[model samples]
Target: MAKYGIIRMQKFHKDAITGIQKHNQREGENSKNKDIDSTRTMFNYDFVNEDKIKYHEEIKKMTATRVKRKIRNDAVLVAEFFVSASPEYMHAMSPDEQRKYFEAALDHISGKYGQQNILYATVHNDESTPHMHVGFVPITEDRRLAAKDYFHGKTKIRRIQDDFHNYMNKRGYDIERGEPSELQHKSVHEFKKQEREKELKQLEQQVAHKEKEIQRMDSFVELKKAPPVEIRSEKRIEELCIQPIEIEAAKTVRGSKVKVEETDFHELLSFSKELQQTLAAEHERTNALSREIDRYQKENKALKHDLKETKQELQVYVAHQDGEVEKAKKRMREKLVHDFSAEQKENVKDEVKRELDKQYEAHISSLSDDLTIEKQKHEKTKKELVQANKMNDSLTKMNIDYIENYVPKEELDKANKEVDELRKENKTLKAWKEKALNWIDKHVEKIKQVSFFQHVGGIQKRNKRQDQEIER
Candidate 1:
C-alpha cells in the first residue's frame, strides 16, 4: 500500500545538539560514543551516533549552507501516515513502487517550489510504515511558502492532494477510498491512474475509428464493377490516408475539388482513363522536374566557384596594371631630371659665351686705339725721316766742301754710328704690328666656335616639349 507523509526540518546549532544530548543523558539514555550507521543522521553534528551524524553530513554536503539550514527547519514539521488496505480499497503500490512514486512526487514538488526550496528527501523503512520524509524550506528566497498565497484560508491542501492523485494515476497505480465518490479519501496515485486510463481509452477509440474508415474505403474499391481507368479520379481522395494520420498531416496538400457529371458514364470513364494517363504523365514530369532542380543546384554551385576564380584573376590583373603604372611614373621622373640637366648645361654654356663675346669686343676696341697710335707714330717717323734725308743731303754738300778745304775725321765717324741705330728701331716697330694682327685672328676663330651655340638648338626643343606638357 502507498503511504503519504510530509517531513519538515528546521535549523539547529551545536548548542542545540549539546542540549539535546544533555537532556537524553539525564533521562538515563547512554548518549555516549557508539558505532551507529552515519546514514541515519538528519543533520551533521558531532554526536555519539556516527550513523546519524554522517547522514546529515551527506545532506549538508549536497546543499549550500543557507539552503541547508532552511530545509533543516522544514524537516521538523513533517507528519507520516500509515495507510491501511481493505476490501473497500486496494493497495496503491508495493514498497519499492511507493519509493518511485514518492520520488516522482518529490520531483514534481521541487519543480513547483523550485529546487532551492527543497533540501533533501529519503524513504525510512525503520519506521512503522514505509514512508518518505521530504525535507523542504517553508520560506522561499522571496520569503513565501508553497500554496500560501492561493490557499490562504481555502482548501489549498485539497488542491495539492488532487494534483498529486492525478499524477500517480497517470503512472498506472491504484486508488484507495471508502467510496468511489469520496475523492478526498483517494490517494494521489489512484487519482492519477484513473485519469490516465480514460485518456488511453479515448486514444484507442480514435485509432479504431480511423481503421474502420480505411477498411470501408478498401471494401468499396474492391467492389467496383468498372475496368481500371487510366485517368484515375483519386485526385479527390489521394490525401486521405497514405501513411499514419500524424505523417499525413505533415505532407503538403494538393489541389481542391471540382464537380463532375454522373449521367455521362461513358464520357466519365473516358475522362477517368485520360486522367489516369495524365497522372502517369505528371508523375514522370515531376520526376523530371526534380532532376532539373538537382542539375540547376549543381550548376549554381559551379557558377559560384567560377565567379570566385574570376574575381581572384581580376585582382591579380589589377595588381599587375598598378605595377606597370608605377614603373611608368618612375621612368617619367628620371627622364624629367635628365632633360632638366641637359637644359641647365646649355644655359651655363650660353652665359659663358656671352661673357666671352663682351671680353672679345673690349679687346678689339683697345686694338683699334693701339692701331691709331701706331699710325700717328708712323707719320711722325716719316716726317722726321724726310727732314733727316734733306739734312743728310745738305750735310753731304757741306762735308764735301769742308773735306776739300780741310775737315776733322772724328766727327764723320760719329755721324755714321747714329744712322745705323735709327734703322734698327724702325724694323722693331713693324714686327710689333704683325704680332697684334695675329692675336686678333685667334680671338675671331674662338668666338666663331662657341660651345654654347652647338647645343642651343637641342635645348630649345626640350624646353618646348616641357612647356607643352605643363599646359596639358
Candidate 2:
C-alpha cells in the first residue's frame, strides 16, 4: 500500500477549548469512541509539551505573554492540527522512526506558526490510527491573535501543504503529499462512510461463509449419525447372540451319558471381535462430528461479534454525517449573511433570529417526545435481549447432534430476517437522534454569537459618536 503523509487543521474558539482538551487528553470517564483501545493509551505521549497540562491555562498564558490586544469572543482560540500518515506506513516503521516522523511534523508546524505559540502537542496511540494533535494559539508575528493571518485563503493553505510535503521528503521520509484536488480533501464523514462500507462488506462475506459451513455440517451430521446396519443370512448372526444348543446324552465311549448343551467357542469369539470393531468405528465418527460442531459454534460466535461491531460503526457514521450536514447548513447561512447589504443584513438577522427561536422551541418539544418514545423502545429492546440471552444459554446446553431439531432451518432464517430489520431500525433511530442533537448545538452556538456581536456593535456605535463630538 501507498503511504502518504496527512495533515488537517481545525479552528476552535474559546467555547470549544474544554471539549478539545477533554478529547485530546482522554480525560473523560467514558469514551464515546469505541474504536479507541484504552490499553494502548499508555503509549501515547506529547512532544512539544512534555507534561499533561490544561489547554485553557496554556491558551491563557500564551495570550497574556504573546498577545497585547483583546481577542474577539468569536475569534479562533486554537488552530488544532491533526498530523499523521497512512497506517500501513506508520506500522512498517520502527518505534524510533514513528517518533521522529511526528517530531518532524511538529517541528515544521512550530516553525511555520511560531514555537512560542504552541499550546500542546500530543501523540495519541489509542485510536484506530496513530496521529498527533498540535495546538497553536495563532499568535501572529506582530503579537496579535489572528488565525486568518495564517490560514486565510486557498493560496496559504496550498502553500502550507506543499511545505509540509517537501519538508518531510527532505527529512528522508518517502511519504507522499496530499493530492491537489477535491479527492484529497475528504470530509471525516466521507472517510468514515468508506471505511464502514468496506468493513460491512467483509462481515457480510464472513456471515455467508459461516452459513454455508453450518449447512454443510447439517448434511454431514445426518449422514454420519444414521443407524448401523444389521447382518442377515441362512446361518445368521442373530443380533450377535450365542445360544447354547442341546446335544443330549449318548454317543461317546468315554461319556457317562449325562445331558449337556454344546457351544461353538471359536465362532462366538470371532463374532465378538467384529462387533467391538464396529462399535469403535461408530464412537470415532461421533467424536469427529462433535469436533466439527465445536468449530462451527466458535465461528458463529465470531460472526455475531463482527456484526455487532459493524452496527456500532454504522451508528458512529450516522452521527458524523448528521454533524457534517448541520455544519454545511450553518456555512450556507453565513454565506447568505455575508452577501447582504448593511441595512438588508439587519432585517435578515432579525427575521432569522425570530424564525430560529420559533424553530428551536418546536424542535425541543419534538425531541422531548421522541426521546420518551425511544426510551420505551429501548426498554423493550432490553427485555428482548434478556430473553434472547436465556434462549442462547438453553441452546448452549443442547446436544450438538440435535441442535437442528430444536432450531429448525426455517426458524433460523426467520430469526436472521428479524435481526436485519432490527439493525435497520436501530440505524434510523440513531440518525434521527444525531440530527436533533446537531441542530440544537448549531442553533445554540448561533444564538451566542449573535448576542456577542450585538454587544460589540453597540460599543462601536458609542465610540463613533464620542469621536464625532470631539471633532465638533
Candidate 3:
C-alpha cells in the first residue's frame, strides 16, 4: 500500500513567504546544479493576483491593516502536501493523472480552509513524488486573519488529517491517516508513579499524625486522674496580707472582712470555670481530627485499588498493541512482495504489448496482401457462380415445364389421399400391437410360476442368490 500523505504547515511573515514562493517557483534555487526535470514546477499561480509572476502584490491585497482584528505577524501559512511515490501511487500515475491528483489535493486543502485564504499554489513533480506547496493566509469564514484560532491546538490538526485521509481514500488512494498521539492521557506507569508519590506523601503525614494522636490517647488512658489544679486557701491568703491589715484597721469590723473575702473567692471561681471550658473544647477537636484521619485512610485504600485496575487495563492495551504491530509488519512485508511482483508483471506486459504490436503490424500487412489475392480469386469465382446460376435456371425451367405437361395436380392429390389412408391403417395396427404386448407383459410373471415359464426363462431351484436378486 502507498504510505500516508504528509502535509506540514508553517507560519511565515510576508518576507519569508516570498522567499518560499521564489524557491518553489525555481527562481531562488541555484540554476547551475538544477535539472530541468528535478525540482520542476508543474504549475504555479498567485491566486490573489491571478498571475504567474509574483505573489507579493497579491498577498498585500488579501491581508492589509484595514482588515479587522488581524494578527500582524503570522499573516501567511506555507504548507507542503507530500504525496507518496512508494508502492507506485505516484510512480504508477501518468503525467496527467499525477497533475490531476496534486491539483485535486490542493483543491482539497483550499476547500478545507476556504479558497479565499489561499494566495499561491504550485505543484512540483520533478521531485521523487508528485506534491504541492501551497501558501494560504489563515482566514476564517468571515475573513479575519486568525492562525491561532485555527491550528493553535492538536484538535484541528487531527481533524484536517482525518478529512484529508477520507478524501484521499474516496479517490482510491491507498493511505491511512495516522492515529492521533495519546499524549493527552498519561501512561499508566507515569500516572501511577505520580499518583503514588502524592499518595505516599499524604500517607506519611497521616500516619505520623495518627501515631501522635494514638500516643496522646494512650497517655490519657494511662493517667488515672486529671492534672491537679492548684488553688489558694482563703484563710492562707488573709494570713499572708489581709489578716494583719484587717486587724490593724479594726479589731471588730466583721463587715469589711467579709467584703475582702468575697472578692478573692469570686476570682478563684472564674479561673476554674475557664480552665474546664478549654479542656472540653480540646477534647472535641481531638475527636474530630481522628475521624478525619480515618476517612483519609479509607480513601487511600480506594486509590490503591483504582491504581491496580488502571495497571491491568494498561497491560491489556499494550498486549493488543503488540499483536497489532505484528500484524501490520506482516501486512507490510506481504505488500512489498506483492508490489514487487506487480511491477515485474507490468514490465512483462509492456514488453509483450510491444511485441504484439510488432506482430499485429506484420499480420495486418500479410492480411492486406492476402486480401488482394483473395479479391482476384473472388472475381474468378463470381464468374463461375454466374455460369452455375444459368445452368440452375435452365434446369428449373425444364423442371417447371415437365411438371405442367406430364405431372397433373389431380393425379398428385389422388395419390396423396391414398397415402394418407394407408398411414391411418398403419397407426391402427400399431395401437393393436401395443395392447397385445401390454397383455403379454402382465401375464408373463404368472407364466413364470407355471412349468412353461420355468423352461422358457431357464429358472433354477430357489436359493439365496435367487431370493436376493428378486426383491419380492
Collision count for each candidate, in order: 30, 0, 0
Off by over 4 Å in 3: 1-3, 30-51, 74-87, 178-472
What is the lDDT, from 0 to 100, of the residue 241 in candidate 1? Answer: 23
Q: TM-score of each candidate?
A: 0.23, 0.51, 0.34
lDDT of 1 at 350: 97
lDDT of 1 by residue, 1-472 (tens): 3333322222322223333333222223223212122233332221112322233443454344444344423232211122222211223456556556566666656665566545445443332223444444444464433223433432554545555556555665454322332334443224323434454465456545545554554444344433534433445424332322221233345424333455554565566566666776776765575566566556555555655565565555456445645754675575455435444778999999999898767656654554455456546655665676576567666655665764467765564454455445444544544443454355445534545434435435644653453233
- Comparing candidate 1 with candidate 2, which one achieves the higher TM-score? 2
TM-score of 1: 0.23
Give the per-residue lDDT of model 3 (tens digit) for 236-281: 4434443322322443555434334666656655665565566556
- Screening candidate 2 with a backbone cut-off below 3 angstroms (N, C-alpha, C), the clashing residue pairs are none
RMSD of each: 41.1, 38.7, 27.0
State each model's CA lDDT, in order.
0.45, 0.68, 0.54
Candidate 3 global lDDT: 0.54
| Model 2 C-alpha lDDT per residue in residues 185-283, reported as the tens digit of each score | 443334434545565576567657756765665565566467755434323443344554334566688674544423465565566667766666666
Give the candidate order by descending lDDT: 2, 3, 1
- Top lDDT model: 2
Query: Which candidate comes out best when scored by TM-score?
Result: 2
